[model samples]
Target chain A: MMPDHTIPPSNIASSAARTVFFVSDGTGITAETFGHSVLTQFELRFRQIRLPFIDSIDKAHDAARKINEAYTNDGKRPIVFSTLVKHDLSSIIRQSNGMHMDLIKTFVDPLEQELGVKSTHTIGRSHNVVDSEEYKNRIEAINFSLAHDDGQSHKSLSTADVILVGVSRSGKTPTSLYLAMQYGLKTANYPLIPEDFERGKLPSALPLFKSKIFGLSITAERLSEIRNERMPGSKYASIANCRYEVNEAELMMRREGIRWLSSTAKSIEEIATTILQEIKS
Target chain B: MMPDHTIPPSNIASSAARTVFFVSDGTGITAETFGHSVLTQFELRFRQIRLPFIDSIDKAHDAARKINEAYTNDGKRPIVFSTLVKHDLSSIIRQSNGMHMDLIKTFVDPLEQELGVKSTHTIGRSHNVVDSEEYKNRIEAINFSLAHDDGQSHKSLSTADVILVGVSRSGKTPTSLYLAMQYGLKTANYPLIPEDFERGKLPSALPLFKSKIFGLSITAERLSEIRNERMPGSKYASIANCRYEVNEAELMMRREGIRWLSSTAKSIEEIATTILQEIKS
Candidate 1:
């Protein structure tokens, strides 16, 4: 019941660190994401806990007890971000000595009223495996992305939804995987190496799939920092080498008429969204 | 402004299919997720569109126009799930002919009152690359995961946060990548083939990391179905072979006292969360 000491203290001296719980009947990913997004607007440190699969009444009681204990230990009300679907279970958590934010019910009631239809009130529906086809496509996309990473395979390049061309450490692999995992997009990432630059042409397999190809570029300084982490003091990680590679890659993309973006300041989500927008549009 | 005929009609005879917009100044991922979770409670069909990076006033006006157009085209008010931080932008969107669900503001107001603090009202904060160390760790974990997938290397087995063992098509690779991408966990997945079952022991390198190992099992029917998608008529897709492999894998996990789960009915999120709970606890 003790406060989690792992969380660093907040800047506010008058208030103790608040214990925040992401309680859900499902995997709790949505609740955690929603809570994290809202909490980022404030300048406070929170001791975070995730209590997933609180489906049964007994589990709900247990979660309520834990929330109450945190409140008692911290001498402040804990923040509970809940996505529980069942009315009884959510009511139990709401009774605890904490500020319970029923993230789902808060919007669901209004939606039900607006639509003039009652909700199903099903538990674990958000992350459930009801749509088997969608699930299979996601798994297939992940496998395809892994197989095609860094141009490891060229047999099925035509099947790719999008192909990414970039220099080493220009944020291609992570972006490719994100697109595959989140959107079930088959992505193949090929690194535009110095050999291709010397040849002054695209990779052999890339010319045919030019329309589906998108490019990613990074600033020389940022690319050097990333590469240096892998191979310190090597010519590959040198700033001059990075500058030349970036310049050549940009020129190549321009000549090939490939749309590109710099990933120096963008997160994987932003990069993936931009790519999806470009390709779909 | 015409109705998108690509979307099939809703089951309801009288009402038309609704249009849902996930509008945000950032990637709109959070808004889309939140809206999707809420909408799943209903049986009505919706054509969802994501409008990300609506940061500028001009873009906000354009998004408002799109929403209004959808309302006019569909003869039903479109549902707008907005996470806009700027007051003027949100107000403009709210003035449109749609039901605007200000997801962030609804919670932010109550949170500000409870904490007696004003929010920063920042844009693009959730998925922004503001925390460089955390971002670097995520990228590193991703690279480490890709390199170690399917037991591709034994060089850094000891560095893995958790290692997964399962038969082919038992859902290990996707789970490993999900753990790595979402939680920054370095996960290595190894397939338990007939060789391991015949030997009647864990993999040679796995025994060294026994404490960090977890197992996944699936029903024979499900395993056969999945494998059949890859190789239609091979022995690998036969129910008898799938049954034998799954039985042997379960026995191996039980004999070794390793914790495991049935992935037959679980989504990747559920499986990954369960594994994270098991390993972390």
Candidate 2:
């Protein structure tokens, strides 16, 4: 008998290909981050594709139509990786005969069985976060062993391989932690308080680390979205304060010759990868 | 002109044609995370293999020997995907007749060119973090945000999609925020204080959110490693204290039938992904 010298693959089954629709109800950037990372992990060993995020159910239908057409033409039963809102597009996917990666359903299954409660799945952001179980990482980071000093001016700038400086709500912390996790970097970030911009100088400790310092700035509106959670109903929540802080911070960063990127529209993954490009460039 | 009938090939090369090495200095997992993700993105395009990790030059030499042998056998230039201490592996890789993805070098290239300072690429964790602009995210999580309110009994768990209960340094906040970012979940986490565990009960608000309650526990050593940074030369840093805290937390988690995981040996990615699995499950 011939020895069946088949290459045993990882858990990812290529034949029973898994289609994960990493849909975002909005721009799909968040969906892309989680969805893409997971996809990247399995794509090499599996058949995987991503849908360019569509904003509405109609657009999702159109995309699904194209996908259905493609598989029909190929005479192959390709899995539909739609990151669409499951409720909005479930019927369409079911009828299309394409195996749709309904993350919501996958998430809801174990939750309902173990917990004995059917998830409304309508809890908006809170419900969505809970559904995906993404809270552990944040909780972990809050408690993760961090070798960072946000308040001490990051005095060891000379020893710093890279330093990040950004205004409040610029998506600095998550990005830094990501770089640290992905690239194993000892990332230290300094927040550009209004006083620093008003004084129009880089944090004093940053000069020596100037070569390694990278600035993070976000659009006032985006910053507001992130900050309103913390300081609701304050001048800080006012678009005016946000705008001033953003504009002043950018000018200060420019004056200090600190290279920076806008964290406004970019996902954390994109921000981290872009910074990696800078590090690798 | 020929009609563009072909799909852009999923990957540039085939797996059997490439000699891939998952290399790192400390643990092999960190290197594998980046190496595997990037490689996976290509869709099985290259002929690949992994060399777990090489600590000593002798191991490097032995691994190089096998890689060269494979290259000779395949009659193709192998690509070595590597992450290692800069001081150790350059010569070894250069000695090999193939392409090598030098993650550290890839990470350092942009820094040297832009900053006008040749990166030593020799710093500790700082080297990995600071070389890239990923510091912004890490800093923001620390430099900004609300205060930790562990003792508040009537805390606003009502708004939380999920509540994380654990001891200090058990990774609650980052996980919570990550859940919110990735899945749009509103996560609230509360640490399991000694008093709560002593009573053999979880936190007050946790039972209400039993379906979404999660726990994170770390090993005594890693917990101490993290605690030492905050309050060095104290009982908090002592292994004994770490053991006590861990034992108590684990006991309470089991007694209460609360789902929990060990954060000691896992990377942030592993931990985060695991939590996502549990919650989704």
Candidate 3:
């Protein structure tokens, strides 16, 4: 089969089309995520493939055969990003006709040297070892965020580590989930509905958790765009309504002395980490 | 300040306590996530500090000073996991009294050699570059997942890339969200309410999108435990109710020719990737 050269050529050199593989004994997410980060530095594009849960010898052999096939068909050595933890499996993958970049084996030597110990050489432990206390905390945090989403429940507000208050479509749900998932922090987000804005004060449900409340605000243009996607041509999606709600929400947060930040031009990671830092401070 | 040695020393050496820092020009999440994956190979404890948004010279200097302080306080060189893209900022970090593992600078030269192209060497480009068309798709996916969560809306069911169904608290919401966040796939998740179980069949709304439907099931005990946390001692949390719901949901999915998997022992990453593979196949 001919290689795919349909990707628009740019400033980067594209002498040959190459395939990249993310192979792991577990979810392959860490390998794929970090490999993508490193690959972003280079301008060349790749046909990315993910092969996860290569825990058995048979699976490892199957992955090797696939990688070898790509190498021969593409007329170039494919790049393999791997996190196979077992030594035998790593050896099997290393024998493939590809540039095997094994993150686990590459770092294990130096870590053992630095820590003065032998590595466990265990597969899937890092990804699936969720029976510990830390993992349980993460699950509990996830449950908290889901229950408190959109102010669905308020019975457990006192248990919340942080409560996010924002106008509708201001990027509250994703931010809340990210914070809980990454930092194991129980986050609850409440939307500022027309009733709250009409009251000209912080919502009555918020006073009990005043110290734990943080606010999220967004640009009127962006808010209107998001709302319009859901309910086009409605009053809620109008630019004038978005602006009015945004202004009133910001004023309410300021009057209540609740810290607020704009979600405009920011990724969920950026928003979550900023909130985590503020909460720590 | 005294070093923290409260961590139980096992096979690994504990000559001195060390502080690990995840430094980045943007959110520091990619750096932290990948660094933690690498660090898991060893059995040592670390005090992790994240210093993000170090985009300027002043912030880099601040981060260097913090790393230097940690080195002196801990009486050992701290381990720094950095994705600093700019040469000048990275040089500042290198000058600190720490072991700086620069993912960008270390791999860029080798990749340039392999690809025969110079890297962009741009700061904060890897994680924060989201203005492209790909990013717009991610936002659309997130919005779709939110709208369809808990079967809130079936208006856009036809547009979904994957529709997930499960009993309440069977790990549908987070899996759907993760699939959207990572893969830019429009995912919709529905909960099998009591009424649906009574009907003894898949929901009528699901049959039209039968090809896109995936079912998630969990152990009855686990489901009961999860539900009990929210509505303790209620019928919804009763072990008998949970067992009945899970059995009915599984049978309904099987009878409808829908693929189903258990979330009892799998992480969200694992579940999402498995479903992605099935969909692709």
Candidate 4:
């Protein structure tokens, strides 16, 4: 699988492309998610390839072959981020021609030492339904978030753990959903439409739950860019309208003593984390 | 902070409650998420406490105190699932009277051995936005999923990476949002309403992208229970109506040769993973 000719160092430097592999015996999501988190610290560009459900020796060999191919083709060692629970499978990937980081194997030994108990060393246990109650809470939170999204239903507003307030595209939906999915928080989001801005006050339905509202603020330029993608050339997508709405929303939130955070530079996880902190505090 | 009194062995055996800590310098999400996955393998029930943004020695000391409190209150050593990147802070947590599993410490040495390169050993690097393009993709995917949720907007259906079709309350919204959040996939979900079931076919807008269609099915019992939560004692929440809708939806999907999975026993992550696999194949 090795390439016949080596690319010039100048070409390699210019392209700045590296191959990255996420290998796992299960969904590979955990490995990929944390792996990306680590990889982001490096400035190099990467082409990611995920090989999930690599439960058997055959699958592991295939994965190793893929990693080796990437290494040979690129004339540089590929980086493999793996979460294989089985020692044999992990070892196979570790032996491949790549810089390997096996998440499960790396931590299991220390966990065993500290616990003074033999690790279960199980596979496919991380993502499975081991506890019915946790599963139920997750599903219930998802349902609650869906029901209360964009203020579609207020009949159960009292049940929400937190309600997110923002303009049409200040990123309320994704943040609400992230809170639900990650933390099992029953999140409800309300968009501050033009009518709400003109009214210059909180909605009638929100007065009772004023304390639960956490506002999201975004830059007008970013809002305009997002709105333009949804409805191009519309007055709603205009920067002027966006700026007006944002300023008014902030003013209203401040007057009502609702804490607000600008989401222009924050990721959904960061935004959700901030909201979780706000609600908890 | 050791417990002054011995908890009765009988009570401990019967209740089986333990305290679990997910400590990290960043969001603590990686620790909490994969820690839960690992903890679920054990039958024992845990009260989880998260300590995030522990980037300082002072915060680490506070975290140790909290862990010690859990140990004393529970009359059992707590389980510490940590992802501390800094050595000094990790050491402080290690000194606490809990079974500590430090993720970064466990993996970094081996990674250094394999790569022959020193890790950044940096705090707050994992979750920060180091790659703007990846961040943009995630935000874009989030926007796409929200816009197309429950067939709210079909204007850009063709742009969807995957289109999920399922009956109401069959767990489409959360699954779609999870796909977008985790995989950065442009997912659009459509509910199979009474009209679609009456027509006994896939939606008119779905055929052109037939290959992208994946269906979610749920048991009538579960569907009824879910619906009853939203609209109690109504026909929409009736078991008979749920059975009819689910059956018709499955039939329509089968007739259209669309692959489907039952979401009754699956989490949103599982459902999204299945859909991701379906689309990939």
Candidate 5:
């Protein structure tokens, strides 16, 4: 294996070419995964310099140095697709005056603007876990409602691009990715929070993707089984809680006109095909 | 958050209910990615438990323990899908009296038998590198010619499932995974090794999935660029050695009736979609 520095530098300073730097504090592999998909939604010519394996601020500087060298020879403003979690890549990017996106900011800013709350912080891969007291409370309530899942109650409604209003522990994430993987449909899933049932309203995001949405409901017992694997000490893992959430979410999805499915018994392939069929119909 | 221990033992003890295990020592996620596809093609029912982060003999034992528990209640023999480069789980598995297969053995066994070689005792992920003295000697007298990629040769191939068949750093792995996650396909690739080219054989496994194979050829210059990223100073990273290997592999693939695409000057997406179309048709 040759060292990265030994490769002769490309003429990155060519005025006509634009740099699309994919930046991240973790391995830039995921950004490349998501960014590659996002890039296809555009037609701009760009180069991909994956700045992977960043775990600290100083490492961020090292990654930034490589990007700077790439830009030194390339005249166009670079379009950066960044997943920088550290505090300084923003400054490095800003200083470059390039066309760049800060991904953490993109996800966080919109979420804050839409929900009016700052996200709770987490270390490493669990960073996406809910961090705020309010959101945490809402998540708990949702977790509570998902405990009472009843299968057929939420069956006949249709108003979601990809409805993922499911009980806690239902197979939603894998199914959503499968739908996207096997088909090109835009998918969004919302856990049917307990508040949604109490207030008799769908979570806001579901409504936005409603016309093409489809719900994912699961059996109470199965929900208990899956949740038991994640955090067993809590009441959330109790069968009774799982039963409550399932019934409530099913009822809420039913009342709100969001079509749903019983994911507990369905295979991932089946869930994906079902969603594809519902959307196509 | 759920607890892993609470999974109820399967009550179905009939032969039809036997659970198969798919295990890998490194990134069981990738191994299962391929394993699940194969399992889906068969009628057998199986359970999937990834044992990634298996760094030592103890870790392998721990994985075997979990796998044993999963199969403990079943009446039929457990069929294991396993890929292990080291840290053998063989002894632990043998104790369980279930039918388990190590993938490397399953794949390499037949090749060894047919080639009549007792095996040169190779190690690790650099499966096809010509760094070995034996490999160098083997290729010296052989010349199976194919097309040499000129860094700009990806324009005309119309049917590509993301053409990727190359030596390491020839940019095949990242490019293929990008295509799969970006453009869904039943994509398959075969690396062009010195052995394959020297013997003028398509490494028998490929012919089984031939229609889906797309060769990923790279420019000698570009390959040196990538090779340098890992080893700064070595014969392997030398531009002259790279040029020789690239020309040899490309010529071998073309002459032996395998089609290919270049990874020298294309963005990840271009390489992805172009080859995607090739294999799609």
Candidate 6:
């Protein structure tokens, strides 16, 4: 028999689980992302905390105090993944009773040597909306995506950088939004319904932007499972219906010469990356 | 006179702008993000490219070929920021004509030392949807945010982790989506309109979720600029109307004892982080 691994909240302090902190002078998102990736390599549980916007010396001291408190409470040194840009703030954080991993400085020093230039040592420059033009484009792309979600409108169909077509619950909407949010690409998605299958043609409006169209298909079983969660005990959630829909969608895509991929085992990030490579190439 | 500084596309080959590649076995988002942060510290122009899903040896060889081709064409070594996990793939890429930056292994070695455990060296684990429960929650959050955007529906209001109340164009939709996408927080946003202000109370539906609400206020000038882009020369876009809306929204929030912040000069990440801190605390 397998051993039960669940620990009660009261006994969590003595467990092997470690407390991890992602500390930064900005949103701390970069630190969290890189740290999370690195942590995933281990088979350990982490009670994660984020301390963002620690730009001032006083805030640094407070963050250090929190780290110290965590260390004292855990009876083990906490690991801190820090992306603090300023030297003084990092120095203050380093004084805490923690194993401080200086994420930014470690890479920055080597990069400075390679590039033969001094780093700006600037704070909060990575994700700030300082480039107004780029920021405006991103917001515009988001609005464009929202306005065009699920074939909501055909008014701006001509303006989309890419258009996605798929049956319902085949992962179109999320991919559209991610493409827009991450790459600033104006994306519109249309549902490939029974009506389109019956007509044996692409949606009338989609033909105009055929070159910008991509299709997403999924396994029938996966589609049925997803649909059953949303609408149980209905034909829309039946395995047979899902099979029909997926088959029809794939046939239509093939007939129209539209490139397509299956989203059954892929994340939205993977789907969006593949679509970007295809459309941009 | 100031220098023009603009290089034509035809002359880009001879210019100092170097080509940079983000190569990874997964989505390559972490590589791009960390590399971008590192590059932002330097004052240089880079033509960025993303090579995602390079998990196999053949793909690694192809990526290296591309890097070498870029080096030959540009007469300089292209900078490659790589997050490849397999040592063989990394070695192949390391042999390319680019200055390869092993983003993952560099940190992974130190992490193994700190944690006293060997890494799994998994490929495509960072952004893949292997954790089914977490992935489902994220997708649910996205759907919840979409269903509740701009106060579209009142169903499941109680399920929201946070509700944002703001005047139009004060940056609600993007923040809600970001919160949902990044943190799996089910967020709903309601617009604080003139109707609510005229009534001298919170929206009838909002008061029920007041404890979960956060307000966003923006500068009148900025609101006007954003509105003008949407609907030019209209009463809605006028500065006076914007000032009235901003003032009334602030008054309503203050009267209702709702926590609020200005979204005028902040990114969605910053706004979301601030809200997370306030609510999670």
Best by DockQ: 1
Which sequence of candidate numbers ranks them by lDDT, best first?
1, 6, 3, 4, 2, 5
Cα lDDT, all candidates: 0.86, 0.55, 0.81, 0.77, 0.50, 0.85
Model 4: how far residue A122 lies from native, Å: 4.9
The DockQ of each candidate is 0.47, 0.04, 0.41, 0.24, 0.01, 0.40
Q: What tens digits encode model 3's per-residue C-alpha lDDT throughout B9-69?
A: 2344565556889999978887887777777666677778889889999999999999999
Give the candidate number with the greatest TM-score: 1
* C-alpha lDDT (0 to 100) for residue B180 of candidate 4: 80
Considering TM-score, where higher is better, how would the candidates rank from best to worst? Answer: 1, 6, 3, 4, 2, 5
True contacts kept of 3: 0.43
Writing each residue's lDDT as its tens digit, candidate 2 over B54-131 gives 657887887778778877987765656565655566568658866665655543443234323444344223223322
lDDT tens readout by residue for model 4, B61-177: 999999999989988898898888888999999999998777676666565564454666777653345235555677788778888988888787878888999999888888888
Candidate 4, A1-281: lDDT as tens digits: 11111211211223646788989887777887677656543444567887888999999999999999999899888888888877898999999999877767666656555444555556765344523555566667777887788889887788787888989889898788888777777888998877877788787689898888899999999899889988998999999999999999998899899989998877777778767766666
DockQ of 5: 0.01
lDDT of 3 at A84: 90
Per-residue alpha-carbon lDDT of candidate 1 for residues B72-150, written as tens digits (9 for 90 to 100): 9998889899999888899999999998899777888899888778877889764345345556667777888888889
Candidate 5 lDDT, A1-281, residue by residue in tens: 10121111222222244556766554454455444433422333355666654666676677666667766777535556666554455556546545555645544444334223343322223222123232233222222222212221232223222446575557664454444333323244556667777777776544654665567787787678767866886799888888888888877777768777776545454566556546545
The window of 10 residues in a row where model 2 chain A has the poorest summed lDDT is: A1-10
| Better candidate number, 1 or 6, judged by lDDT | 1
What candidate 2 gets wrong by more than 4 Å, as runs, is A1-159, A220-234, A237-240, B1-155, B169-187, B197-207, B218-234, B237-240
Report the Cα lDDT for candidate 5: 0.50
Error of 4 at B177 (Å): 1.3
Better of 1 and 5 by lDDT: 1
**Distance from true location, Cα of B114 in model 3, Å:** 0.8
What lDDT tens digits, residue by residue, belong to model 2 across residues A1-281? Answer: 11111212234333443333433333333333433322332212333333443545796677667667756665555444333434666556556646544444533344345324344433123223322222333333333313453544444445455677887768766666665544445567778888887677877777776777788898788688667867887888778999998899888888878789987655565576566546645
Show the colliding residue pairs in model 6. none
Report the Cα lDDT for residue B262, model 1. Answer: 90
How would you encode candidate 3's per-residue C-alpha lDDT over A39-134 as one tens digit per residue? 877778787888999999999999999999999999888889898988899889999998877877766667677656677677765344556556
